[model samples]
Target chain A: MTTRRTRLSPEERRTQLLDLGAHLFATRSVEEISIDVLAEEAGVSRGLLYHYFGNKSDFREAVIRHAVEDLVAQTAPPAEGEPVERLLASLGVYVDYVLANLTLYRSLVRAAAGGTDEVLALYEEGRAALTDRIFREDAQGEILVDTPRTRLVVRGWSAMTEEMVLSWAEDPAGMTREELLGVLALSLPALVELTP
Target chain B: MTTRRTRLSPEERRTQLLDLGAHLFATRSVEEISIDVLAEEAGVSRGLLYHYFGNKSDFREAVIRHAVEDLVAQTAPPAEGEPVERLLASLGVYVDYVLANLTLYRSLVRAAAGGTDEVLALYEEGRAALTDRIFREDAQGEILVDTPRTRLVVRGWSAMTEEMVLSWAEDPAGMTREELLGVLALSLPALVELTP
Candidate 1:
């Protein structure tokens, strides 16, 4: 959590509250981030926290959404580089982002694995957004991949990336950063090129 | 559930009870399969069921282990064929096995997603067994993949395969079985070759 000014506009305060909630969530369990805990973290009262984000579920959902946006923006493919370079850069950033928010990343996975229908749906939506953004056009109006086969390929690749990241996160197994990044970045195009 | 003989040895009866439990679990939530329900399903008394399987938790674990064994056995690569042919055949049977036990498969996923330590550890062990098998020697003593990088590749491919099958299971999207099989089978070599 970062220090913030005590006074702000309502919209600014709401944004700050959500960002704070997301930051706290990145390292702590959801159960630990109760309204009282959040308020304490933000140096605000419980009433103020509720006034900003409604109830706890609503607040948690908002924070999750915020965190996803943070991930998407931070790892968005650069608009002005060679396509491979752009992809590699985005992947490096993505791995870093996940490492920074591993607890949140894991909870998203666990939620998808066994959460309620609403939560599972939200998890799918977040994943789809992440996957779709990868194929979005770069500055030259060129797209990396767009077709039913490639869509499936990329979605599958997303799963591969997730699995590799989680496994490597648990134990590096003497894998160097370059090798790990190479596996993630290079394997995508390798799979997509199997278009036929 | 299959028909049983009027008389069975203790070992045969125990095997039958576990198989029946596995069968019921294929389509029903774990919560629904209570001890009474299992006893009634098996045409036995509660005491008999408990005596055979220890307790409800133990019984469920055994059933899950049984299902994983079924998956491994049914999908084990045909002992004799071209490498690619062997993989395609294995993938085909694997997809069928998952379809036949979709509910059980989903629950295993859900358990891995949020189950307690013991369940999660068991889930990891089961997955490792599955993935490690793909790299084991074929009849000629040739392994499909054996290095650390290839091991990672195959494991990542396994995740991709899992995601594609689960998503396709939800809705085929007019994708024929052949196409799905091709994607899952062919993509493994494509990804493994990417290792530099």
Candidate 2:
């Protein structure tokens, strides 16, 4: 296997390792990818791999964390846009990202289902960030009360969006992309209104 | 270990095994409960356990199937309530079931996250049944177009309810059960209205 032979800072090296891990995870099952293979692929010593990740599971978590961060970054609204425009832009980006990275997305789903605490935390963090972004963008500088009920409603909407996107991903022919986005947008006002 | 010594019909014995499995699963991780121990506890041979469930994963799937069926049976609205009353009643039963069976509920969630096809299928089946019940009860014999968009909305609502209920189970003090039911009820009309 070809290996990178470049001197780099710790941060750069960590990013390199995470990128390699994410690439491997996208194509192979977590159980199928071994640390030795990862090290070989990255041209790093096994000790260096462990130095950064501690273990295979930790390495896998880092990869998932990276993917989640990537998703949030990709889907977050632009710095300046109308509330409706930003919402549509975010949703469109989300659908596009999931479609482009279906395999990696499935791996994340599988990891979450496995109920590993670290993985679940990462998934939740990503979910919370996305939800916050949606709310923040929709607020558009308006002072809306952020009560517990409102929090739950946003979370509920986020969960629903995830389920809808996942289902749509699995069966794209079932509904047009525009229809999915339209349905999600249409439901939000009522969902928000229900928040007590 | 205390083992039962009663002779049971095949169906009865299957129920017994499932009950024991559920009991074990409630307190132990799926990996912790082995076939040998389960057979020992159930007063059956290992081969007999295999005869009933091809393997440990299969046995776990069976337990999940049983739980899903139980949830469906417990939460399906009665045949004689008004539409709104039946919807609220079904939601109440669903919340009660999740709250009462938190461990089994967590196991089901974990299994779904784990990306096991059988477990996911069982979850989807349960979700679909619950969503269909909600729609059917809400329709009150009125014929509605069951298009893909409508199906997506119901599924989205079901997913939201699940996330809300799961969150509520984790921290009941965050939202009262009544409030949870109320928020869910209020959202349905808008969701259904958008279901073209």
Candidate 3:
């Protein structure tokens, strides 16, 4: 195990460092946690950590980007279920993910809110991926069509899903998991139906 | 008119200054514009501007808060219309307000995204007002009920409306105003209807 940890390839080591940083980021905001703190937490030297991710700002942005990609990748819809079922499954995963990493989710939101262009762009890239997923399936009776109006409504619905999920995830006691899933599932078809 | 400008009451003068600040903010981001520029634009001395709003941070927050209040107050729904009509009416005003103050609107959004608590809170205050307005009407055959499910859905809808409107407003040529208004008016009912 010691040899394995010491002999990780550059890419593997970088990912390991980012994973450590992401874990630290889960409990602390990006701004509050510094590169030195991350190095100390990961049991690596400052020079080594900086070498993996350039400067302080670059390191923070890289960590945020890593987390965003992880979320997007993790929530990819299931391959077997019906369209709505797949979306619900993805949403369930999303709810659990945010709930487990409450502060990490929060700080990413804060990073986006902080208006750093790179962070904001990363956030948008993640959102656009989710939004595009709603239109990805051309199932036998796909309810949503690709058009300007539907696109706007779905994008708007994405915002709704985000708000509802974040608010519910923050206070899991306040809403049932079933209700959260129901709202997410039902709102999309209903919204697209009313997009005239 | 000159005398009125010079001898305006304290509240009036403060409003006058904030209005000027808001106008300048419409064209420039909050951080990019300074107190000196605001005072110069308003034809007031820097000291007077400082007197009205203490320091740079306070002044920027005050301006943001004032703009929020302005948006809320201006979008008050009509007194004599069907429930849906009233909402559409207010939405029309909201659409216009955001349209005319595009950069100002963008700046406030940036401020919220920037994660300034005061600014974010103000933005929420404005959003809550809009959401509450949906539940405000007890008109005949009101379509929405005040339940936990409904509340969550409406809040989500509010987010949808904001995103759609902002995106639509940014590219008016991409979508017709009628289509924008239609989406806003039609989506609430569709979303609420599906909240179960």
The lDDT leader among the candidates is 3
Assign candidate 3 its CAPRI class: medium
Model 2, range B1-196, lDDT digits (tens) per residue? 7598878899998887887877776677655666777877767788988999998888877877877887899887878866666778888998998878787787777777685677778887888887776656656433234666667766777889888888877865367888889888767667767654
Candidate 3, pairs of clashing residues: A113-B113, A113-B114, A114-B113, A114-B114
Evaluate every candidate with DockQ and list the scores. Answer: 0.59, 0.52, 0.61
User: Candidate 1 residues B1-196, lDDT tens each?
Assistant: 7697589899988888878887787668654555677778768789988898888788777777777777777888878777778888988998897788888887787877677666677777878887776766343424354767677767788889988887778777556788888777777767766665
Two-chain DockQ for model 2: 0.52
Better of 2 and 3 by lDDT: 3
What is the fnat score of candidate 1? Answer: 0.62
Over A124-150, each residue of candidate 3 has an lDDT whose tens digit, in order, gives 998887777767763454768787777
Strongest candidate by DockQ: 3
Off by over 4 Å in 1: A1-6, A40-43, A138-145, B1-5, B40-44, B138-145
The residue-by-residue lDDT of candidate 2 on A48-131, one tens digit each, is 889998988877778788889989988877778666666777888998998888787877867766857887789889988887
Candidate 1, B70: how far from true, in Å?
1.3
The TM-score values for the models, in the order shown, are: 0.88, 0.83, 0.92
Runs of candidate 3 with Cα error greater than 4 angstroms are: A1-6, A139-141, A172-174, B1-6, B139-141, B172-174
TM-score of 2: 0.83
TM-score of chain A of each: 0.86, 0.83, 0.91
Considering summed lDDT, which 10 consecutive residues are worst modelled in model 3 chain B?
B132-141
Fraction of true interface contacts that also occur in model 2? 0.69
